[model samples]
Target: MKRLLFIIALFVVPAFALEIQNLRVVPKNIDAGNVTRIMFKLSGPAKLSINVKGLNGASVTSLISNVLYPAGQFSIPWKTPKKIESGYYIPVITAVDQISGESVTKQIETRTAKMISLPFTTSDLPGGNKEISYSIDKAALVSIRVGINNGPMYKIISNWELTQPGAYSVKWDGWDGDHVIKVDQLANYLIDIKYIPVEIDALYVTNPKNISKKTIVPASEILRQINAFVPKYSVAVSNKKIASNSKNNESINLDINVDDNTLEELGDIPYEYVLYIDGKRYGEIENTTSPYNWEISTKNLSKGSHVFTLMICTSIEQINTRSFKVTL
Candidate 1:
């Protein structure tokens, strides 16, 4: 199986606008494949074009272009790039004087998610330092835990962090310093990882994409703690329940299978894929032709956020929508 990592980007309030002021992206730290909302207030009627540009100073995506609006506050939703490889970006908002056709531009720099391919895998065993190689494109905190015989995995080793690009092996003896581990004591082994995702937008995401409606967290606090690890972002797929520190826990492997009826219904039809998180629209793939196989990894989502996938069949007008709630 192929492994994938999740990420996001930073956003900020744009430079001053004569007719427009306080141009900012809501949930400033937008995850890969998720949407961020941009808001601003107008002093008078104006024509505006809100576009996100790549590093080459070229327009990547235009959220709003040449649209006229009355003097008032408004929000425009902007989608981040779907892929992690898209590096840093800038959001530029321009206003044209309705009567003169002259324009003013305001821009702000932001970060984007990066992907990492790790050498740590299912093959790493619990003998001595189970040597595993890994590398990252940017500074990141990587957390690794070990499990034995389909039982609870212990966070035996972590904090072997990386901030630069290089290849190296991190040895793990499979002990939490409080416990000892042996290779032959179990029937199967499991490993899990949780890394502080690279801040694609800023050093800290003052505003999380799924911000609490009632809770008010200051920007400074979010920035100071942005690099800290969040467990809701942890990734682990296993057939057995993670063993706890308690004694006498039995090990069992769980298998997942689909019925023939379900398999038959799984065939693809022509459709479009729309991704939304917490009731906000983010990414869309138009005309996903036959074989209708497309994928979006929400590994970057915070705990308690809801991911909605809408697959609309164009031929017969059938809509299949799935909503996944992240429980942690």
Candidate 2:
């Protein structure tokens, strides 16, 4: 009877759920060209997945996906991507017990986090009389645009301008392209910024005529390639007419010509052109052969003057804009 009781007691031990503890991200404030480590403890054997996400809740990268980890302390090293945007990031970890169908999810504490501070401005003026200021944490391409809410972007303060880490300020004269912005207009501003990285593989693969194949590429040549990455394009319309006839809804032919004429000239980098009308996105053409054409429909537009803006952009952000008045 004593042996039988001991066997029954052993079989009655309840199973515990999956658990994670002591989660940490070392070197919370990662610098450019640095690596971070994620460390954690598990109570029992489980499959785990770890991912880093930005402040906007977008997954930036995944360290591991559903990999089995033994019941012990584990550490994961993650090297920051060369072209990662400057901002804050959070590490999310998940663990699952296969047999019990139990799972646990947790994020690192805010105190122990990764962050890259960005530029900011304190003044807000509708008349555009105030000076916009920002601090660049690293060398980057920056641009600024201002416009009324849900209307045409009237002024472009900068266009893919190379800037170094420091404090910078620029004042706006409150001028829309044609005239001074009115006091009643509610204008909005956009600061497009992105860091540039030296891409050797891209240069080799693209085989741009400007950059010759060599075992070692000089810094000046690399800088030239970086500058070429900024999109230089021109916009043209076949007829520049909103409607061929008022009775029917007709589309107009729009063409965008890349100044370089060939993708190889730009290292075959991914890019796109976005068309905006009255501050709203109209159409977009992503990485494709040159001579991008889009059909702009004028059926919904009111019979008056409208702003037609063509913006060139890359994975990072907008590089340049070409805006003009189109009267229907």
- In every candidate, how many clashes are there? 9, 0
Best by lDDT: 2
lDDT of each: 0.46, 0.59
Total clashes, candidate 1? 9
Residue lDDT tens for model 1, 170-234: 67664433233343244575565544334434211223434221212121222233332121111
Colliding residue pairs in candidate 1: 9-201, 10-200, 10-201, 111-200, 111-201, 112-200, 151-243, 152-242, 152-243
Which regions in candidate 2 have their CA more than 4 angstroms from the true location?
A: 1-117, 122-128, 135-166, 175-184, 187-249, 261-264
In terms of lDDT, the poorest run of 10 residues in model 1 is 228-237
Instruction: Give lDDT tens digits, candidate 2, residues 183-276.
Output: 2254464433333422111101111222221122122222443333345333333334334443354555666665654354456567777888
* Residue ranges of candidate 1 with Cα displaced over 4 Å: 1-17, 84-86, 109-328
Model 2 residue 228 distance off true place after TM-score fit, in angstroms = 16
lDDT of 1: 0.46
